[model samples]
Target: MNTAPRRPVQLYRALLAAYPREFRGEYGAAMQQLFVDQYRRARTPGERTALWLRTLADTAMAAISEWLKAWRTAPPAARLVRAAGILFIIGGIFVPLAWWLGTLRPSFDYPYRYQPFVQDVLAPALFMAALTAFTGGAICLLLGMWPAANGHQRLALLSSALGSTASIVGWGALGLQLGDSWWSFAMGGLTLFFLGVLWAGLAADARNPLPHAPGAWVLAGLWIPVSALAGAVYEMVTGRWLDGPDWVFGLALMLTSLGMLWVGRGLAQMPVQAARAQDGGDA
Candidate 1:
């Protein structure tokens, strides 16, 4: 009777991609050997199939384990701290929105009696909406940490979806208030376009681990500063500031940098893990 190797080793190697870098590096050869030994011992075809199934399942579990710890590639306590920071920024946006919706409601409703479109209504509303968008986007940006730490991709997607929706809604509300002035219209158009782009790119493809996505954290980090700096430059040029807090611009910059640092740290881990995985596979 012919008794040759029945199972293909390549299938097992392919499945190993699901395992964590460290686990695969240290125990992959040993595990592969064990699998080969078991395969050789199997008396029936059913036993071989069951063994392959188990191997795949174990590899899948290992992948999940590594994904959960992905945030360790980031800063210490990065998830908790970033979440809190985002919450505070969201609160800041609410403050101005509350103030305007309370103090300026009448002026906004009956614009004929006051400065009408520019000072009394649209400007404040647009400014408030922009800040609200910033807050929403920032919180969504922080969702990356949660997903990385806990393997909560669903939660991450939901958070990012909400944030992206808020930004788009807020931008649209503000866009409608802009008058016929070319510059104002252009600015509103640009803001709306950007909101749409983010919605399409990040919000739409939340499920896929697109390499370009950088998750929400990096996007938010890049977004907040650009928004703040743009707003600041606009304020300086137009002789106006958002909510009378010029310092907030600097704060936005600082927080944005911190977010970037977190993301950068995460990216740095990829190479190390890849190297380890390669070395382990070779062994």
Candidate 2:
């Protein structure tokens, strides 16, 4: 029997390069040999094409599965941070929606107008949702920041502590029905400030490159200052508290939350990536 075509074998070898260098180095020759053997056995063009296609699909799937496994084996701290990132995102979404539906919607026509149903039922439920968001988000942030702290990340530690504290205070204020009071404003402002700090620190931390897409962490960090400025301007121009036009604030909140989620995901995958890189370097 004739040997397998050199071009097809070379092409298959190229495809296998999609895997990590470690994996390719360990099993590449064996895999190439097996593929060549199979190729030589196929008589028809259709059969050969089918075999190559199957090999490609199988290779892609195997690579993905291995990567996932590596990610799953990441450090516990990374996992915790990832969870926190998700909480930030969750709180970011529901908190705004709750505000729009429960408070803003009722008061749009008449500012501070109190509807009995909205105030008595829907408002309370939304408040609970907000409370959950704040509490959960705080816990996640604190947990996520713990590893960074141990790694001697002073800015990260400080920002995490402040952010977590603000979240807790925000939750308590909501529980006390002090939503419109000075306490709420102070805590909210503090929260925003610390979030900016956290993101700045994250951006500066060369040791830990955020796992999310580029600019996401920066944007999330910047949103706090920008939103605060906008709210301040609105307050100044209108001579009233920032309220309504819920869509704008809501959209901003969602984007920030999504950014947090992405960052957390990145943090979670960091350990695995680092380990793989170290292994590759060692090899």
Candidate 3:
């Protein structure tokens, strides 16, 4: 009947907020009564400590289960990233399909290298659409990870904003037929965009809640920079997107697409993982 012993019970009652209102409304009183009884029965300090620890563990498990069932209620950041993931996946699909379609065109076929983004009917349409989606998605990925960013949000945002703007403007320049070659204008934007992606990946990796999510982002970011650098090197050596066999470029694209797919999946599962992390005080 000592009042001091009831503090633990009170704390546990407050922690009940972890459960949904409907659950509490239905079983709240009974659960509290049971906890009170259990606390009172713990006459020794060690017993009370044990009970509190056990109760917290049980509550964390229950909270994770219940919260997962309400994943639709995840924070805005989670939803944004989820949507970005889907967009990335869509872009990934479009790029290869566009490449395949472009390969069928006799004029654009480049042996030993992946087909470059080209101006055509369906292929160009798909390629542009894919780039638009990818740029938007990459920006969202950066913004979505903003809240959880340990210290890299500002740099990530600046790079993405500048890069995305450059990319969009570069495309606009081509649309206006301002450039002699698409690559002449496109390379600048593409370079900035690639850098943005690199920083964004690092930012996401900093404090990302989902497993392997950062790795996926990094993989998605790596392809372009590597490809561009290699292409530059190849140009210096022999030019023309590389000499000899061209499987490496093709493989990089394939892996980048896979990386997008992985990032999409990870974002999809992020709501559950984030909720659990927050509940466990790890978020």
Candidate 4:
């Protein structure tokens, strides 16, 4: 009776442990025995190595499939929160698109230099979409904070709310040709504050993956304050608000949009258990 190689069998059994606990408890021994039998029946070392590689690949694929299944079957609240995060990402993307389009006019003038199509059509549409998107995102995020709300979640909620309100006020001010008025200043200030709060919360959360992505949210967060300060200083010195080049403003908008997209993607990808932990639940 030829016995299976002890080392290879042991390794195979160890790999089986990667499966879910319930699955391992039920079928682990049977699976190990089957693998050992196959190992003993192999004709050569090459065959055994091939079997081991196949098993590893299958195990990895199975693990990913199980995780996707779990996400699909997660509770309704978890799904809603993830959906809200997606909305945030979409809304964030629109911010830059609107700004870029508005700046593509013939002149780089202060506030009213936009082409007719940009001012009459795209601007209003984008602003309305932003208002709707942020408002919906805020409501969903707030609802997702049911049982226990962490500081980060609360900050996200507040930021979304402020963003929604600012969009509404901004749209109205634009309609009344008050783009450079105090209302405009107030909207800009509110937007900066919201971005700061959101970035702080995201940075503090260790589970979020935004830090790993290109153009991390930290840089985006820092850019806003720095740009605002620089713009202010320029205004004071030059005795004009729009003295800076147009590309600088465009760059700032791009950074803000990218940062929000990264944060939203991170939030959407967070596991249900981790999200619950944000509300004081077991991770």
lDDT computed for candidate 3:
0.67
1-283 per-residue lDDT for model 2 (tens digits): 3457889987988898666444676788888888988998889999998998899899999988765664476454545555555555565565555655554445464445557556666666664565455455445545555443434344544554565566556655765787656455555644554464455445544444345355666655566557777777898999986775867777766666666555544543344343333233321
Best by TM-score: 3
**Model 4: which residue pairs collide?**
none
Residue clash pairs of candidate 3: 112-246, 235-239
Lowest lDDT sum, 10 consecutive residues, model 4, at 205-214
TM-score against native, each model = 0.31, 0.53, 0.59, 0.58
Pick the lDDT winner: 3
Backbone atom clashes (below 3 Å) for every candidate: 0, 1, 2, 0
Report the error of model 4 at residue 170, Å: 3.3
Instruction: Report per-prediction Cα RMSD to one decimal.
Output: 16.9, 9.2, 14.1, 10.0
Better of 2 and 3 by TM-score: 3
Name the candidate, 1 or 2, with the larger lDDT value: 2
lDDT of 4: 0.64
Q: What is the C-alpha lDDT of each candidate?
A: 0.48, 0.59, 0.67, 0.64
